[model samples]
Target: MPDHPDTVLTPSASAAGVAITPTSASARPRGRRRRRPLTRAGSLGLNVLSAVAGILIWWTLAKVGFNLPTPAAVAKQAGHLLADGTLEQDAMASLRRVLIGFCLGCAVAVPVGFLMGWYPVARALIEPWVQFFRTIPPLALIPLAVVLFGIDETPKIIVIFLAAFLACVIAAFQGVVSIDRTLINAARVLGAGDLTIFRRVVIPASMPYILVGMRIGLGSSWATVVAAELIAAQEGLGHRMQSAELYYDLPTIFVGIITIGILGLLMDRVLLMAERRLTVWQERR
Candidate 1:
């Protein structure tokens, strides 16, 4: 094809001592490309804004008309409780119960869940019972636990243990069953024995699910402990809240609730970090 009259060309070397190039896609000066907004800063700022908004709403409702205490009142009450050592006592008591119960639950659930998943006979014998118990809320067993173990720390711990155990068992069971068969078969081809394959492949692959179950179990333990404390005993946040309710001590109640939420959030964050560390080899979206 011949160049048309409208076609423009530039000389490589000109008499004017300038080397010119054709105006083409490669020759154009690019405009300043827009940078992406910083997501972390935006997210943190948004979270702070949301918290401030929630505080304002709470303040308005409490200050303007509601019978509830304002955030300021709650803060004052929290300060008093802190100074008097009541908050520390209650928080420690609750923490103790949750940790003990959660540990017990995980200790039992993980092994039982793995067994049930690995063996059909175990699954057949236990699955029915697991399903039945899981259907019943942990709170419902409080009366039975109290009757069997007495109203002391035993009953409270038992209820929390049950709450954690059932949830964790299911999670672990699912994790075991979801393991890839190819890995197990490959191990077998490489002369790995059953025990070796299970130890090296099954356990590692199922660890993420176990951690997930532990997180769920931890939450359940906290909830059950609170309910157990409400029913019978002293020194836990639940007990404190229950006592406060008798005198309409709204600020104390708010403090206890907030403390539980904060503790739960912190524990969940720790568990999430653990899961990420353990599952580092697994592909993520």
Candidate 2:
């Protein structure tokens, strides 16, 4: 043992017949270091590389006798669509429906979800209907929607709304339900009221879940809007694709598919950015 209790006899020190004083040990650098995240330039380069690789693979598949249209053909079709303003009009139509439906659904869902999760009485009253509707696929409701609301924008928007609502509501409910009970108790012990605790603790804790749900709901909205458009009326990517399918226009179909994917990916990225901004206080890997 060292004469001074503050001296630590570490393994390396013992082997070298030296004592590591507390001050020296404290002054030593830590072994483990944090890894640096990718720089924006590096991340951008990687994304570009990935996209190029995907295109190369797609090109190879097209050359290998796949029925898929080549990238060039799809681009040509896209150019034609753009030249005539078909793509813009269709994209705007779809975007309008998705935005309106998704926004309204999320607006309603978050409060309802909070109520369901926070109040037992509310849960008892609301959960059964939520679950029942959730089980019935939004696509399956097309006939009912058409019959009730007619084959106009109303039914299409309603279907998209249902899709978004179900996804977000479940996410929000789970977020609230999954909050740490200890946090609430600690807040109470700190003389915090229910409203204060909820505002400070519950909402922050539940935000990640709510954001994840919103992302999912957004995807659901897009998917439902496309399918709704396919079954219903005119101007939209889904309608364009359905028309192309009848004529076996592979390039047009590919163009629609790519357009939808790109739009969805862009929207999801926006949501992801929002989530990161909102959850800055939350720890991440």
Candidate 3:
């Protein structure tokens, strides 16, 4: 008998009067191997190193007259903005807009997406509109939004809302549609009702897609808000950048850019954590 099912005995060894037993499956080396993932500390260290390297590159570019401000100069400008409460006010304004629009977008999107995915009638009715709107950039509607909703917070919020909505809805719709039919059939064969299958199988399987969509939507919201603020708005990082651009304030521009990046990164990290927590059963590299 072979040592294992996978083991093979060579005829040459048998002819030589030697029993040639191949290594057991457990003892044999694997054909493919995966590298160990970095520990949390190592990941953090790498992030810091990357940030440092980026700063060094930026400094080098600035020295080469690339019309960029040095990191120290940007930091100094940030301190000045902070001292006068300008940074805080601008940050709060942008944060409020993003939060409200993003939340409302998600609240509406999940249900709508679920409906479209689960019901053929809903999908037929809603999909065309969704695709049409998606092709039209949210920024392009800024003018219409302003005309209809006025040059207030409403228009800005509306634009952001649309951006987030489009991104999240598509993600959710794809998630639901992409669920394995075999799982649904299995559940049905086991005498599971539609509701039971939806609750137990569909929801869990679609969650990863929903979360990914939300992340994409969140990015879209930020982008839209900044663009919306660029026109006829006050008290936002985008508005501040616009104001700075008038006088060629490179340091202030850098500060605003860095602040927005940091805020977005922090929010993204929160979503990532949620994804990890909620989708623990999902395999990842």
Candidate 4:
């Protein structure tokens, strides 16, 4: 006869013809786990509640003469801006600059960071400069960037690039260097060449950090672009906000601030989804 399921059962087993049913290792007793996953409805309801609470708080503060604009006023302003096409134009301009700078920065940062982590000589040579540059705020370079490239697309893009590059380089470097030496040794034992090991072992293991770096870089790029646009720009969200501030158009300022936050959050969500998809091998906590 084939092996009985109960044959391998631990601790408790009934006699052979007793019609014993085996308990699965995966099965858990009721209420044993600390928390249950939130349902879709529950999550949506919670988000809606939070939004309502925020609006209420803002309204109360405005009523108490805190000189703050109410949520309703901000929403109305957002609607007007949307209707006038000003918000859309500014959003597109900002998005273009950020995407270009972010792509360029990551293109350079990843390879340099990977090399630095992989080779001791590369690390010794490049790490000091990276550390030094990282210490300098991206905004602090605005003066030099303007002097060199002028208040043009070049300067704006360069500032954004610097912000992204500095953030991502460190992340990628740490990711690569933090890898399990044992894994690399095992790959070597299996006759994997340096390039092969990097491809098959290092990249996959370090991808989490790379993606994390990119996410941070994205946030930095957005923030730096705002500061860059503040310097000199024809059309961008930051430029719009600066223009609004001069006129004391609190509603428009609020619109710009909210729009940037929403866009950043959406982009972050996209990156998180990508990370989950790519790192399916990683265990979830």
Candidate 5:
């Protein structure tokens, strides 16, 4: 297209000693590159905002004459319990159970999942059972687990294990199965045997999936911990909550729920940090 008749195109040599060029998509400044998110700061801000919002709702509802306990009431109860060391006792016991069950579940799940995903015969045999049992809720099996193991640490641990095991197995198995076939082929072409391929290519490739499973399993573990401690538990958050419920102590109930939430959140962040550290070389896709 010719320059418009009204356009006073300057001569190349007479453009104030600078070369003039036609405008084009390439000539325009690229739109400012999207800035990377301030993830830590943003996360902190969001959590703070959530806390503030929750407090505001609590205050508002209490002021509007709701039967629910005020935030102060909850705070008072938490403080009273904390001062008497009751809170710590329960908290520590709960933490102990959670860690024990979670770690054991992951230890078993990861290896079993790896085998299932890595070996054809192993997978064919185990996948059916995994699928079948995974569909059952941890709570649903509580009756049987309790009856079998009794209302001791065994049953609670078993409940936690079920929660952790199912989630982790699924993640680990998926991670292994989802590995790039090309990567495996490349390794094989380079003379990597099946075992070597698994240890090298498969393990690294499946790490993200495994980490994701760990995160998910931790959440499920927390959810189950409450139920696990509901029976034959003398000093756990769940026991305290059940006791509170019997007396309609809403503040204690809220505190227990909040404690669980905070604990779970912290565990998740720790897992995330571990994942990032381990997978530093992998471009997060």
Candidate 6:
């Protein structure tokens, strides 16, 4: 009998089914090469097909006189916005604010998160404040923000900060608290101090979780940007869309929606790539 599935035995009739040679057997790459894997083009085409189906449904509803515009009209409007440069300006303005606020949010959240996780006293003191803020929607603070900071970039950026900060804090805190105690014990057994244990074991173990939290926070920040800009803003994709709505320009509205979607997709992919590169050890896991 073979010791493992990978080992094969050649049974000889002369020996009445006695095992002859239990040798390791290797399969050829022909198995993989024979399978016709789906190409990138095929995957893209499927996505395009789905989009066309959605547009067709939208067009049908529009022709039957629903509120939405047809696909062609929206495409034409997108082209016009591209040529006029309004789209570029507004999108950039919104992106700049989100980036600035996201940076501030992560900077504050990470340290606080670490503190809350590492120290019980800090957790008891800080967790309540985090919970209180997290419960409040980013939009609810708009009026207070406007009153406090006025209708300027400051207020808008503050809104973004609120959205991003609350997200990251909780994530980092949870990551640290959830670390395996066994790892800590192992490090201590090896003569590591508290600082060494935290620095070498706890931080690395918690990083994957902390990074995931930031990714979520980034999305929240972007979503909150438009809401932040919606209130008394001079320029931004959200502001532009709101302004278009006032004029009842459906095509312009479509362009704003699509622009936001595309930009969000791009940013998310960049974050995902960064996370993948930084956490390659997790992959080999």
TM-score of 5: 0.86
Clashes of each: 0, 0, 0, 0, 0, 0
lDDT (0 to 1) per candidate: 0.89, 0.91, 0.92, 0.90, 0.87, 0.86
Q: What TM-score would candidate 2 get against the native?
A: 0.87
> Where does candidate 6 stray beyond 4 Å?
1-49, 283-285
Model 3: lDDT equals 0.92
Error of 2 at 233 (Å): 1.3
Give the higher-TM-score candidate: 1 or 6: 1
Candidate 2 at residue 147, lDDT?
A: 91
Please, what are the lDDT tens digits per residue for candidate 3 over residues 124-236? 99999999999999999999999998878999999999999999999889999999999999999999998999899988999999999999999999999999999858789
Q: Taking the tens digit of each residue's C-alpha lDDT, what string does model 5 give over 101-165?
A: 99999999998999998899999999999999899999888889888978878888888988899
Ranking of models by lDDT:
3, 2, 4, 1, 5, 6
- lDDT per residue (tens digit) for residues 184-265 in model 1: 8899999999799878998889898899889989988999999999988867999999999999999999999999988888
Best by lDDT: 3
| Candidate 6 lDDT, 34-132, residue by residue in tens | 457778799889989998898889889999988988889998988888899988899999999988999899899988999999899999999999999
TM-score of each: 0.83, 0.87, 0.90, 0.86, 0.86, 0.81
Q: Pick the candidate with the highest TM-score.
A: 3
For model 3, the stretches where C-alpha displacement exceeds 4 angstroms are: 1-33
Ten residues in sequence with the least summed lDDT for candidate 6: 21-30
Pick by lDDT: 4 or 6, better one: 4
Residue 238 CA displacement from its true place in model 2, Å = 0.5
If candidate 4 were superposed on the true structure by all CA atoms, what would the RMSD be?
5.1
Model 2 misplaced stretches (Cα beyond 4 Å):
1-36
Model 1 lDDT on a 0 to 1 scale = 0.89
